[model samples]
Target: AAEHLAATRAGRRAPHRVAVAGSTYSVFPVRAGARTPQAVGVSREVRETVLSDWLLVVEADAGDWAEERLDLLYGVTQLIAVERDRRDAARTVRRRLAQEVLELVQTGAAPAEIAARLRVAAPVLLPGLGAAPHWQVVVARVEWEDGTAETGPVAQSLLEEILVDPHATGPEHSDRIAVAHTGDEAVALVPLPAVSTEHDGSETGVLADALLESVREPLSAGLDGDGRVTLGVSAAVHSAEGLRGA
Candidate 1:
């Protein structure tokens, strides 16, 4: 399918451009045999074209402005490429970790085995060996009013958007957090420094609130009835053994 699209673009004489956003791509398909400006109903040189099949003719004063906008569009295209690559890498890591963790929980793997898997999947996101780490788990509930098959893709897309900044509710900081969706729920594992205090109730509440608030509206479009998502945040576990209990 992609090869066919590439061939179509390659056959065109007019400069073709493509822009990507997340998993979707917007492509400008140049009309076949459109070699010059006269073929596309333009008096002056055509500087830019849009997905709508309209040519942006270059004018005297607007040429520079049009060129600048095209440059910005190119930058946006680059950003989209980077974002797609980052998401792909992140998904791969998360899938591997989830599978390893499941094996550890179900088959009772040794701590060393689990740690080895962690190192392979997520070295930077998870703190290295020795001291115990804190963990949080989240589950998503998918609800559709009419119950269409498109709901799944919609939910998946929204989950990706929420993972943009897994931590942080406000616009201040975008905490680098890892995210993975399991079945109908997106299981988000938040790692923090080991906290073993009784007065950490406020901190727990804040974290829970942030997670719920950030995911609420983004997942609302596909939900209906009394359906609402509630995240199950496990208490700070010292080891992989505790993940089994949660």
Candidate 2:
């Protein structure tokens, strides 16, 4: 997989094929009749504040953008940029709120104070929820076998991506999550809906297996051979009092 993006001269170039993760190297393969296909396109990088190595590849049928409907491509790129801006803003809020909540938790603040903070953070984190959801803690540590001072920030970014709710409706597009980093660790306060009466609580909330299911390979490749990430999920807790023990 090619992960690094590079500046390209103005126009389209055709490359056979390659693989990538959360890829932006856009390839628009066009075929005429039953012909196999002509592969070529332009690569434009979209600047996402959290993870910016995304490339947009556009392969065309005519070997160039002029009659290949370049206007439509520009529109698509603009749409993507706008959506990235929206998501990035939401993530910034989540990180800031997580930092505050983690500070209170670590300092052993009163449960009442913690609960109050959670209350204020709830609406922002879980917009459109009719009521506040139960909460859980997800703790992750990212470290290099060789070691580096950048571990904490890296962990924070990784956790944010992992915790996003792919099915989430509306603009936030994330689980009711607040993630903060301290030292080599990132802690996420994940908001969950209440368990139903007949169902076992065990069936609800995040599971370590499920959280890592899709991301395991990508995160591994990102570690550069000498780094690793470890994650743990806490049982759901109802209020601030349970946050510490969780």
* Candidate 1: residue pairs that collide: none
Error of 1 at 219 (Å): 3.2
For candidate 1, lDDT tens digit of each residue in 1-246?
A: 232233232343323333334332333223433343234324421211110122222222222345456444444444554655565566665555655565565588887776665545444454342334555554444543344332332333344445454344533221224445444555555555455343544225225567677655533322323234445656655566666676
* Highest TM-score model number: 2
For each candidate, the alpha-carbon lDDT, in order, equals: 0.43, 0.62
Candidate 1, 198: how far from true, in Å? 20
TM-score of each: 0.49, 0.66
Give the C-alpha miss distance for residue 208 in model 2, angstroms: 1.0
CA shift of 19, model 2, Å:
6.3
Residues 1-246, candidate 2, lDDT per residue (tens digit)?
122212111122432223455433434222112111222232222111112122346433323446346445544555665665676676887788889999999999999999988888888866656666788899988766656346677677667777765665555546467889999898998877664443544227788788888666555545546556798899988888899999
Mark the 10 consecutive residues where model 2 has the least summed lDDT.
Answer: 30-39
